[model samples]
Target: MAARTHGPATTSTWAPPSGKPPLASRIMRATWRGLPAKRYDVGWEPGLRVPAADGGPLMTDHYFPRAEGDFPTLLVRSPYGRGLPWSPMYGVLFAEQGFHVVLQSCRGTGGSGGGFDLWRNEAADGRATVSWLREQPWFDGSLGTVGPSYLGYVQWALAADPPPELKAMVVQVGLHDPHALFHAHGALNLETALAVGTGMTYQHRGMAAFVKATLRLQRRLGEATTAQPLRGAHVAALGGEVPWLDEVMTHPDAEDVYWNGASLGEVAERHRVPTSLITGWHDALADQTFEQYDRLRRAGCETSVLVGPWTHTSALQQGWPEVFAESLAWLRAHLYGDPSGLRPTRVRVHVGGADVGGADEWRDMEDWPPAAVVGPWFATARKDLTRQAPADRAPLASFRYDPGDPTPSLGGPLLSRTAGSRDNRTLEARDDVLTFTGPPLTEPLDVLGPVSARLSVSTDTGHADVFTRLCDVDPQGRSVNVCDGLGRLRTDGQEASDVTVPMSQTAHRFAVGHRVRWQISGGAHPRFARNPGNGESPVDATAFAPVRITLHAGSALMLAAPADGAGPDTAANG
Candidate 1:
């Protein structure tokens, strides 16, 4: 998971250099011709001071359409600073689309006064900013919120008490649960935390400083992640102690009082704001977006979701055209009473193609996880996946997991350049990994919803972690990951137990001749901190041990396929 990143890049293909309208126009025309045409020249105001709840001045930048007409405001709050992508993409380009865009740095970053404390002050500062907006002469009393990554978290924080002026929201690759972001099912998501720490510590300083910090982290990552006492291991990469990172890392327990009020997911249930949730299949926070959509939909709030085949950063780069268009449509329909641009369907997802088969295309649906039927592919001692049930109870596979040499994590849903689907032959070859391969499919199998693995297993050590993955294996034997998840096990001393590991949601097509695969591993290292194979806290453990894990034949891979025509495909005939 090296080179993992969060938020928009300092520079973007969508955001051209300032003072060069010709270059910007040419780039947009060449790459994003489908977007709505620019309607106004943008006006900019830098170094505006907006007071926080406690009178601490927060640095802000306001970008508006130069014309005299009243326009809806787009409030973008981010801790990553107001420059590059934020200015050109959100400030300039969006302003050109006939909206007033206010880009503000969060408290204690980007020249804003006060200490940054992660999720603590966002709600208060958001309210304060809205209060400030009301006093502005140009404000038209209608507001919409938009941003990505941490920027999205700020939107959720603001929605804790949805301002009367807030008519719509677009949360791209957003996060709601701070606990889930850093820890997955009790194991620490080590690499993402480190990358995020680097971003928070240096991004506001300037691009050069941020790049330097990122390079330093990459150089020292091996040393930091392998440190004896995993706690405080990030000091070297981060250049210094980041209190919030330290706090979150140490407090892995979601129920800890230390995390009180850290999650703002409940806000979605309470508000009826027209919201658009955007995420990539491989984005680290894609599950969060799915959760947001589910909550919003269940509450009968007007909502839609767009999922693309991209990683966290790529969603803003390679997928920017579609992302920007979807965002503009949602904002226009909700904030400006113009629904013409809105798509007829509530869901749009990019169904991925296999190396040799499956159609690569965008699909529109009335709702997400669109009426899928659950099908189980049972694992066998022969290392084959089949629709038939196990004949009898037996150990299907066994592997030794050594903490000294843990299984390395390959690409899939990480926040890195290396994130997303990648050939998994190297990973599947590891001694600690057990793979079950299904027969080549005769027909395309479209899996469009959540995938999970139900395993009956026992570990020599009472403590272990299970990492299960679903993959698409093409004709030439290239096994690429689609979705995966990690779950920690705590059993009563070597006793067999049943544990279900949710592999998350995915929209993918397993084409003809492509075989489905279920890969099981003891752990995916640095993507998750190596379990010390003891009961001790993974973060604080200094002693390491080797553990042997066994999987029973009854274990099965569960996939959600469309109720019609989508199911476990039978073996292709000779």
Candidate 2:
């Protein structure tokens, strides 16, 4: 193999021979003489049409190590272009660790033929790809899979009825329930779905103008900004609007349509492969990852879960270096003869607010909601409002929700170009936001795991929406959003009994001076489909009729805290 170096040091492109060491081995030996030297090779080649079981063709780009002899392969099936930075880097990393990597473009994506059909055909295509790899000259008959999000979904699909060559998988930020991830709690995730759909469609088109426009927007607004003018531009450029976007926006419920597209629960029950599952606390797909972990564990499958303190993008930019190392180690141990690495049984999560340089500290346990922890927080409500407390009799507070000027999303894990560090103090000042403050805590309170709110409400109209926000109020009265949940109620569903809605789980420390605050309102616009107030379609409803919703204290809002000791070690208000 040819060798080249773009940096100061000279390095060979391929692994050296056993006796006559190559330049790459010499460079590695010089750098770390006492430690193990790692080397890798990279090159690009044409696509091979792997015949699907159903008589279709799936095109794949083969990326195998040039080290000679047989080697285990790491297959990554992705709807996004095979050459996307994340997957390509993953392929290279695995190859460096002494495994061949195959990056395949899913059907209807990239150079692959046929129309896109989501997960409908992934099982057959993935099986075919694995079979083809096993037949290749470089195959060692062992295989593993790795990728995040959609790529992770493909791994899950293939594992459902795994090929004989499949051995292990590393799934990150993947959805186990499409309904929940797409239409969370009956509310359409318009911003995330639309952004992802549009971005992928643009990639499929291979339009330089579209890529340039997207990059410019991403640069100016940051990756957290979700709202964009490109929806119209993309529709115009594509010559028609994408039907999937509309389907998602219109059907904001867990219906058969979505369930058919994603049957992860069933997939997990049937999967026999060992798997490593990773997720972000703030990612939109966190629920899916967690659900998959739980299901796989129940099915008597060997599984490991890792929850990080970052968002979807953070998995790439901030956490990729360490995560990639851990993942590669896992793959190597399972695929190759390396026996030093083993997957953990319990989940390891970053315990935030630990004052460890604002980095996530890993905590291991036997199961979720650790055996020692119990969930027990009182739901105190008066009239229509609710508060979570061990003992409190505070009256219900009211806040107006104006549709004309709704709450702007300030980043917690949605597909948007906005930066995740937006200050939410200004939004807290609005009259439409009802803020309840708790007295300063006497001791440090560690809040870890999922949060929930119970509310008793009545609406002037038959249909209404409720948005609950959990925030940490610092000494300066700046409120930072920690977690949030929303619920839409029909006229009949708005009963007097308290209703429970789950907020995102987080690890934080509420110090003596810091206070826990709950912001109650009706809606978080654009991020969620707007409630029409007239019981009409949320998307097409243009009429801005106002609806009066009441929260009665003592009868309305209550807070449920995790059982004592269930919170993280320390808490820090963001």
Candidate 3:
């Protein structure tokens, strides 16, 4: 099919098209939809095949005002079908608010031609689509991109060499570190690699086929992720071609050219795009979002961040009203040159804990970590995390880790369906996981910044893994996860000590009477692929091996606390 040739302006007519709600009705339905000065009825334009730099034409569907005047464009390009995130309601909502909304399906998905080889194809296609949009009569030669996850990645790909028409972008949970996305240090997220990747196997196929394939893959995902010699098991679960999955499994090292070519680290620094980032404290990409904001700002790019208190999908679902309002304000100020729409702030974090309906209070700060001092809590031989430093080396605290029965994931930052804080009391009961609980706080202890754990340990096995977690122990003794980190190591027949595991960032207030707890474990099950302790890649290893992890007096966990109030016994930095 040929692309739509939008000609010069003609007298436009407004009407509520058949089987669709009116613009006014939709706006009223929204709890927090931005109301623009100009309002127009939306008109749907579908089956528009935009020609790409690649021979294949990308399929697009536009939802725009019926008014005859050209308007600023908001483009969302993703491998996921356009209806997602945007849905029909959001598509019309944007269009009705006096913007031209373009939903483009990335190559090989949503009937667009070409294989979806991940982020590699986005740069050229994104630039070409911008060129095509510039030619359209409805576009005012200004464009703003908005979406979450992969949709956000497409924006970064375009920002590498931004087209003249490109104005700004609203990135939500964007992936900046390709290495961390797949391999967390030397470990792979088995569920993501096997299940999520498998579900995307039929992206090129029609919706029906894709839906059926995804459903089938998910039903057997747990077993598939645990399969031995996992190099090709994901493909088998997909029951169709997933060549990329094979390639990823075979190459577990981040040093691979494939990861370098796709990672957004270098490309982000190369260009400046007025970007607004909306991320969640519990989202898998939370740390990456903050990292990108800092990097972009340092590179002289105009960037603002809003960190919420929700999971990966919940960030989009429950946070739509909030994030969209901020994003729309950002777009209005940036793309439309209306400064009143946006308030400048380097970082706006959701101070977590003691929440109503899981929503935290927001606080704007000059930087990511809000002027906090590093306070350390040392591990004692008596199995307690303390503020006092050990005067002498104490006896070693011991725990045996068996990969066959790795501790189950109680959820913190994994991208599975169940991705958020879960009660950890049950998980802490396991003999393999060592628990170090602090005394009940008589007053509130507000921790806000990057959290990490340093372990001084000696493992009997040549290769071992360490997983450390921070939790809030309530009055009832229920331990809820706050944040956690995992470290994979290869001792090569020697004992390793002072291992550092960088946990995900968080901004939580431990309420009065709530005791802080740390669960030091070897593995967190399939959330992070279990280390076999044999120097073998997790991609192909399922066999469990027992390793004795001996923790000595020097092991410690630390958090960011206010510098103003501290004691002499508190150690500085981890």
Candidate 4:
């Protein structure tokens, strides 16, 4: 889509055809029927023009309580357009809850003037919107921000130079670093990048356009991921050249000049706005949310976090009730001067049970990580995971990863439909993937906090990627993923390399009769762009090589056991 510049236009109200709700009232009623009782009738005025920093239009929709005297306002700026999910879900619903909701389309989207330049213009554009709010008659100066994904990013952008009226923020499944989203551990997150590109390209157009674009991407995914040069391979799947995708893919280094000022994480350290962060354990941006929480806590900012079991999208759908309640509580406590709705704890996480006799309930705590006991379970030559150290320092396992036939990615943290925990029995059966299974637990074991794998590995190519995962094998012999991470290995001199692969964080309980399994592989293809097995960049490589990886016996999986000593301290086979 070509960029368009528009002269300022008079604010106009747009009504739904047939003079009814934008969507049929019954559909809206059914969708949110279980939510809190409506407090007011929603009044909407669409197509309000808020001038950007450069005088271009930032098209907005105003959802207000029809009988409101004065109320706090919530600002939600998004590039995905103010339709479908956003219209009724955020604009109308939040408005009915007694807050004036201004849902605006980011510049260059949804009839907004000026070309969208990704993250470059958000800070200035957001500040301009707040300035516009100050002139409105209903502006009572009590303000908060809430939304998910890019919407969360915009909140951070605004927090960088927070206006005086800004009181609170709720960032759900948010990310502060775009670089980390596209490139993690020095490899492209190919699938997520493509999915994001597709959404940005067509989602603003409408649901049909977005759905069609997604289908096209799905059809061409295999071909695009396998193309030799890798540079222009995504054009076919993405429908056209996505300049930002190309720029990010080509520049893998986070410190590269191309990514300067792209990360807004510093805002968390500098600002003291009471922020509530929500993310799912399987959400693609879970790590970012953790980072946000840590920074905000360290800066002495009043902050709270809620981690659930849903993925990036599901957090807004299936997890909406919980997410909405958490968000509304935070906004009410800060914006409405009512702490009655707030929870007593600053941290809350949903412990995943998954058909096992585990703690499948919401846990509240004073802080994150909660002082868990750290323990290491070692890998053995017999393909066993035990707290008992290996008797001898010997080679534990070996696998050859061929980039031409790279190991495929299964369910885990991802943006697409194939995200969240999946049975890993098939993935573990792959020749390139090695699994070290612990004996069936005699009792239920709960793992909370961060997980990591410390490996003493040697690769024939001296350059490869290591993918480490922690899984829960049920009594039925089903291996399901919990959390996983990928680390890049590039060494020329060491006989063996000791590297730490962060498996992000998780709150899960392993049931009685379940087993703990540590799975290791050279690469999770297309999940983390295939490693070329040489020093060459995966994107620019036209040649591929295979790497034989050897795992030393002393390598171990480190986990954070609950602080209460409520679980097993050692892995013992039943």
- Write model 3 residue lDDT over 1-574, tens digit each, in one string: 1222334432233232333433443544454444343477777776689998876889988777766655678988877675533544356767777677888889888788988786778889998898888677556677888888888888888888888777788898887665666777778877666655754555435457667776777687666666776667665568866787777656768887777777777765755778888898888888788778778877888888988878887876777667767887888777667677565556777777756235446776666776688778988767788998888555457788887777777788867667888899888888988988899899888888889987777778867888899999889888889999888865534354667889988888898888888888888877877788777777777566788887777677889986674311221110
Q: What tens digits encode model 4's per-residue C-alpha lDDT throughout 122-149? A: 9999999999998876777779999999
Residue 487, model 3: Cα distance from true site in angstroms: 0.8
Give the alpha carbon lDDT tens digit for every residue of 286-378 in model 2. 777777877888888877877776677676556665567657756766676464564443566765544424544566655664423423333
Clashing pairs in model 1? 4-416
Clashes (N, CA, C under 3 Å) per candidate: 1, 38, 0, 0
Off-target runs (Cα >4 Å) in candidate 3 are 1-38, 202-215, 356-360, 393-395, 492-496, 565-574
Per-residue lDDT tens digits for candidate 1, residues 151-209, read: 99999999988899999999999999889999999999999999889988888887789
Ranking by TM-score: 4, 1, 3, 2
What TM-score, to 2 decimals, does candidate 4 have? 0.94
TM-score of each: 0.93, 0.82, 0.90, 0.94
RMSD, candidate 3, Å: 5.7
Least well predicted 10-residue stretch by lDDT in candidate 4: 1-10
Q: What is the Cα-based lDDT of residue 252 in candidate 2? A: 64
